[model samples]
Target: MNFEAAKTLCRSFPGVTEDTKWGNDIVFSVGDKMFAVTNLGEATGMSFKVEDERFLELTDRPGIIPAPYLARAKWVYVEDAKALGDAEAAELLRRSYELVFGKLTKKLQREIGGA
Candidate 1:
């Protein structure tokens, strides 16, 4: 997928917001916690949070690796977005968004719902 596609998919979820940061990276966040970010020059690649098990499994595949600086935090980088397929990428993004969103306060969760 590309930037627009990624952005579109990411924003489809509740409480998602987008902004460009870190010079050229576009970050998607929920309640001030980032779930994904643009990487590998523009939108050719992406980094997002994943389960520890999936992080190890995904990085074993081509075009994926541990994210720079955030590897220890269980973020995985997709070197070539196409390698991830559209459906799976969307699922992963949704999962990441949910994971971060789940950490929000109960009041914040209610706010997100009302958003």
Candidate 2:
């Protein structure tokens, strides 16, 4: 999946936003909290959260590694964004969105709901 595709999928979720930060990095957020990021200049790049169990499983694969500064938080960096396939990548993005969205306060969720 390319960054453009990723950004399109990410923005499909409620209360989602995107921005270019740290120069060339594309950051995706929900409720103002980041859930995924990728370096635009990199040939193949995407960093996203996964379940802790999958974290151990994924990092064992080639072209995948603990994301810099966010590994401990269960984020994995995909050297080739398409490594996971388009459908799988979309699923992961939704899961990441749900995980981050679920953490928001009830009030915030309600407000978002109203929006």
Clashes found in each candidate (C-alpha, N, C closer than 3 A):
0, 1
- Kindly list the per-residue Cα lDDT of model 1 for residues 4-115, writing each as its tens digit: 5877788788888888787788888999899999843446788999987898999989889999999999999998766787888888888999889988999999999998
The segments of candidate 2 whose C-alpha lies over 4 angstroms from its true place after superposition are: 41-43
lDDT of each: 0.86, 0.83
Q: How close is candidate 1 to the true structure, as a TM-score?
A: 0.91
Angstrom error at residue 32, model 2: 1.0
